[model samples]
Target: MRDYPNDQNLQDLQERYHLFAHMDAAIIDAERDKACPEGPLQDLVVGLKANIASIGANWSAGLRHRIAITAQSDAHLTKRLRDHGARILPGLNMDAAALGGGTDNPDLGRTANPHAPDHSAGGSSGGSAAAVATGLCDVAIGTDTLGSIRIPASYCGVFGLKPTFGLIGRSGIVPLAPSLDTVGILTARAGDVWPVLQALAGPDGGDTDSQPAPAQWANQTATPDAQGLRIGIPQQVSTVECTPETLVALASARTTLEQAGAHVETIDMPEWNPAKLRQKAFLMTEAEGAATFAEALGTAGTLPRTVERLLTYGSTLSAAKLVAGMAEIRAARVQLARSFAQVDVLLMPTTPQRAFQADAPAPANQADFTALANAGGVPALAVPIEVAGQALPASVQLVGPAWSEPRLIRLAMVLESAF
Candidate 1:
């Protein structure tokens, strides 16, 4: 299980990639001693994104004021991974308070893209994606309150899965918004995802949001046989907004899936007005996040500008507006369910554009497509797809009905083959 690096070299890797917020060799060794005989993630080096709790690691969600905070007990996800024999290398960096898509944390150093070092790694889970893409670890666990996992994976040319809300318990992690937060994984390959999910699924007595798993939920296979599957490209994604490069990548992926025997169709998702949905998602996320960080409200001035702005915006929202926004979200979910009734999956570019340069202000358009998954409480997978002449990676998201992780994984397997 100690296959990757010695303690000294792990530090070197961490510094090279800005992948970890805090790391401890002794804690990793202790977990190895207690590791179960044979489990899903045995011998794998897994990087836990900084916000999720690990008893001895820094649990700061990349804010300067919280840098000294450390977890006294393992988060539910941490315990599950250790029991399955996964070695926790170091927790990765995230956006300050996990509010943005860029992993530009002023507290911990920015996590750079392995493909293009000067480019941003999509975040707030940027470090995890960077770690996996750069071979610093075999896999990494990350949270997605709003496209954090998938955006970074897309930026770093790796695979990221945001499981359905409540599919995995959220007992020990810090919350950006409990209603939207979910634990997920970033890996080098599509085939590596299901095992980690298997180990983490099931109700934890602690998390009030935990849900029962379906029979054989973890037994679903991710083989590359996509024959006869219906793949729907939403009119929203197919028509406008995505960058020319992202659209090209999407076209290539669609063609590849068709060749693999999947039936492709263009479907109308008129209810999903990107602009309106974006506004509603912002209102609800910021409001919930403001409440989540209520204790830190006074210290908001110490946070990164973007994060502070979000918290302030969230705090200032009218409760009546928030309530109305949530009602629209519920109705949107129902509409999404009806659309999926005719198609097995709805596909779109994970972000409208690729990762911006490290120095650029994080783009406002980054989360336009992905927050829908969080709002709808469905599963979404971001799979890497290659562009014709670009060195960086672009990706498309595969979204399925709630509890349809198995199906999404299988589709991701098929889509990833295009690269």
Candidate 2:
């Protein structure tokens, strides 16, 4: 369906972040010795985002405070993993300050597409996606505010889920847009997600937003054999923005679901003005980001050009406009939730477009396909759908009512099963 590969693609997306900042430092020639001492995660190596804080370099109050936040949170995470038996690798960087800009690391070479080195690895979780896709690690953590997790996942041909906001605590993650920011995971296999999810799904007490869904919700009610799933296909998604292969892949995925015994239906939604919605979305994000990074912005004589500009733009949003945007989001969320009542999950093309050139800056309008979930406080997962001769993943976001991650993941498992 979608085909994105090669060195050109990689070179096309390197303008954003420093990709080399985070990678595996320890190299093991072979698997761990069978007789070697092992713990719970003895077989796994976890990748941390540079934004997360850790022991020596830990400084949550620094100019780019994300690393410190992650390091601090990871201290607990590391102990828990070690007790269980896992190793925590160094943290990776994102578009500066997690702005979704891509990376600039030269050695690893800007987190380019693993399938095709010329293309890009998506962001702000680009590095995480790169790390996982390349088999450098079994699992890696990322932050999603809007579509950070899903976008890169789609680009890199991996599995990414932005759990219902608050389901995963953000105490240790950097505050991109604190209200919307959520910690998420990227993995090779669809089923592999469960282990990490189980480990980090509960509340941490510090984040007022965190609330794990009940276990019963984790067991999906919809059974494939009893009857087919009621999947809603949004009509608004049919357009030129989606490449031929993307459309084809989505159609094929739908067909596969049907063959698997899931029922599918076509649904219509409030037509959105992509540009206006993007503007409103940015207002909320930039404003929240400005507040989150206020300390860094105030003390630092100068900040990264892009970050400073974004922060400045965020600062200019009038309180009145911000309030109006919030109201719009709340009202929209209510309607969207009601819409889900008729369908188990809603399916659509994740980005409707192909991966950008690796050397180019992240598309200014990149978030169009992924932000609604953040606005709605729903859980959405991006699973790799078929692409072209090569594999280019088209996203099918499954969003359920608040705290419905269990159901969401189950539904996604079925969709990804075809691949």
Candidate 3:
């Protein structure tokens, strides 16, 4: 088995993504008390977002404890994790405003690209991706409005799942794009993804958006194994900044699956441009986030600097623009839905590139690949295949229509097994 080194390994992991806030030694203590726990996850430490509301140590507490500037522990989520016999470690952070800078929490600050530490880990969910990739935690929970979850997963080279909207509860999580916001998970492998998903998903009475998910153990009747799997790869998505190594990673995976008797098709979605769709997503999310925080900002209370600026900018948005953006988003969603109807699963580059250096400053443009799912309200996953030379990690994104999470996961499971 391949083992990543531990000398600065955690720090190296911490630098790769921006979602983790802090680690809770106490959480580990709590886990040790459990008897006959589940397999690997029985003793796993999971990171969460700072905005999740919990009764014990929270984002504010993390700051004071000097554990993390952005790591927040949701009292509610933490309590639930305990009830389920799981431990809640510290929360992770995105950039100050959950904007472009990367992970939050100044002390735990932005994650360095695990491979480099100079580039970005991706946003909002950067810490979560970083934590999982570096083995800081078995799995981490993140919130996705635009590309918060998927982008960082891509950049950091890991597996991330954004379930269909409303499948997972959002009561205790932070709000970015309210309508678009969904709880997501990041992990090292597909098997790990399902376990965390099982724990965190399903309807919660506390969250209004929570809806009843399918039976946990029952397999969806429609999706079969890789032998009968029909996958779509959008041609347009490949036109992005994908390098030879990245392409090889995906191509090799595709070839292996093909050899295993899975059906692979090159899809053409002339209407799909991940970059353009993401721009609209950004505007819509910022506008909605502005509205969500309007009251808080109206007061003289201070928010993280990035959040403050985001709110201020949102304040400037006109109702007309918001309405127009929604209309456009709706159209895009319809188009994407129609596209998905042509195939059971769609695959694309999780990120156009790989991880950058940990200590490096923010790049000019970020969150490009991860925004499409948010715009379309579809379910997606980012699965890492390789951490090639010079670059740390690279992954492939699998997309499915809304409410198709079960099917998506099954497919991901096959891919996981193949790899």
How accurate locally, in lDDT, is each candidate?
0.83, 0.65, 0.65
- Which candidate leads in TM-score? 1
Tell me how far candidate 2 lies from the true structure as C-alpha RMSD in angstroms: 5.9
Give lDDT tens digits, candidate 3, residues 174-252. Answer: 5666788888888787766665666665667777777766564334442325677678887876657666767877897
The superposed Cα distance between candidate 1 and the true structure at residue 158, in angstroms, equals: 0.6
Q: What is the lDDT of residue 406 in candidate 1?
A: 80
Each model's TM-score?
0.95, 0.83, 0.82
Q: Is candidate 1 or candidate 3 better by TM-score?
A: 1
Q: Supply candidate 3's per-residue lDDT for 337.
A: 75
Candidate 3 has an lDDT of 0.65
- Check candidate 1 and list the clashing pairs: none
Instruction: Report the C-alpha lDDT of model 2 over 39-98, residue by residue, as the tens digit.
Output: 445546666665665444332221343332323334444344445555554455466677
Model 1 scores a TM of 0.95
Per residue, candidate 1 scores C-alpha lDDT tens digits across 107-224 of: 6788888888899998989999998998878889999977899999999999999998888889888888888888899999898888888888988888898997788777777677
